[model samples]
Target: MDEIEVEAVDTLDPGVARDTAEYVLYGGKGGVGKTTMAAATALASANDGTATLVVSTDPAHSLSDTLEFDVPSRPARVREDAPLWAVEIDPDDALSQAGMFGQDGGFAGGLDSLLGGAAGDTAEDAAMMPGADEAAAMQLLLEYMDDERFDRVVVDTAPTGHTLRLLELPEVMDSMVGRLMQLRDRLGGMMEGLSGMFGGDDDATEEDQFGDLDAVKERVQRLRAVLTDPTRTDFRVVLVPEEMSVLEAQRLTDRLDEFGVPVGTVVVNRVMEPLADAVDVPDEAFVEPNPEGCEFCSRRWDVQQAALAEAQDLFREYDVKRVPLLADEVRGEQPLRVVAACLD
Candidate 1:
């Protein structure tokens, strides 16, 4: 693995400045500053005159608090003067709109009717199915991708597990749907042959049994194309300087590669600045002076330095950007701007 230097002006690095991808995804373990990085990127894009939308797909949304604005389910302006929009995807609402929870005209209803049953699977039960959240989240992302209002979309994705599920959903759903199509063809052919023997109508329309299957297949194909296309989409990994965070990020990067998504950048957030500049020390070690610093800060900084070196060695294949810890929590455009500057 080789490391490279990144050139930047203010908060915009060469990687971001030169990027033309339509979608940017930031994913990592929980509490790793994904939302902050995503928001800062979106804000920088808007400041650079690109129409951008920053969205949070995590169930526990922090976009609102991070931006210090009321973000609705639909895209709303985060600032009056800037060309930036923000929203938090509601999983239940997305599922309902996509017809995943429909009891009368959806998958559960059709299945129940085909089996001649009265009480079918409830919406709650359907929601509990494996990858349900991922499926809904994918639909929401597809909607934004199809929209032409924004030039770019920055996604603050869910934690590692859910994000991986979302990335793998397209292939899994495509295979399942392909099998269903084959079964439908076989059953339809058999039914028609039996009807001919009985002199019954062979052209009866039973398309309702395969409600929206074709559409679903097409959607999966489209999403797969965009996600796997390196020119259109890029995934960035964010982590703090810690053993758990570095290991998790490595695992996430490997999984993304399996899905054929590009992991172009790794952001090391909350890196500690050198304490030696702030605390003047004698040539020899002196432990009795409490005025200059405390033991806890020194110990924590030492640990952070070790973890930082480990992260650098582990992620040497990718472009790494270091962000120092801020004095104040990053909220609103001003604080986000500060972070963006540090990203360089």
Candidate 2:
């Protein structure tokens, strides 16, 4: 076994590792079965009778597809063993919600409407500006992660870059944001002040009443504490049995360590095996994934298996898990249930 995988395996809970973590963060490179795994894990937890919320933060969303449910703000109950709610948080919706808190013509609303709408998408202006989506989601998450909400949250994060952006934001307030802390609430309204600061006369909107610079700072701190508190957030990295996934997993490990989030384990998915050719098959090339007939199909299976075993060996230093590739995509309760059973 590789050193990294060894370390990761060591972190395994003797019995679910239940107390060590409350919220679980699943993230990795794009297209590595993360969404499926996150949904399945949430399903498992919810089945165990804990109130669970499975959330997707990825811009290029696939949670709905994976769950086979229309999860567009409509929290679908995937399992009845317990109360399980799933939400695909739309960043645009968050921005609109944030706008309601701003004074009429307030900087928060104008900026929010601007960010969540056209300007956020028009690559002609600049593709990176939609970063506000990440911020907006983080903002809402921070504001709502208190004791009143769900019991445990399962966060399906975006691809590497965007996930890193979210990680970086928690510390922004503690950095050099003294001016932000000085802004007032109630009598001292920054959003309202911002609208007028830009030389416009307008009263604050309903949404503005909920927002305060101090509240924002506090919110960031709360979220940072929630996610970074080692005992609260358990960060799991997912990868497929391929060179690119392995490379990305290693870097993700470094980033998690750097950010102070606890590393849980790595999941290696989609390792295929040899199939019998209808005509002539090698005696040694017998494996259950049995075969999708391509010219070099057997060799392809060998290479994939080799890569996966190599990953297991290479990342032995951390917790490493192997999941055979499913012949069909897993969607909805039945498939998710199958995955949970496999994990068991």
TM-score for each candidate, following the candidate numbering:
0.80, 0.72
**Clashing residue pairs found in predicted model 1:** none
Candidate 2 structure quality by residue, lDDT tens digits, 43-84? 777767677778888877798898776777535675555667
Where is model 2 poorest over a 10-residue stretch in terms of lDDT? 1-10
List model 1 lDDT by residue over 133-228, tens digit each.
Answer: 457767888988777889999999999988887887777667656654555565554322222211224463455335455677889899989988
RMSD of each: 8.1, 8.2
Which stretches in model 1 have alpha-carbon errors above 4 Å?
A: 1-18, 100-129, 189-211, 274-292
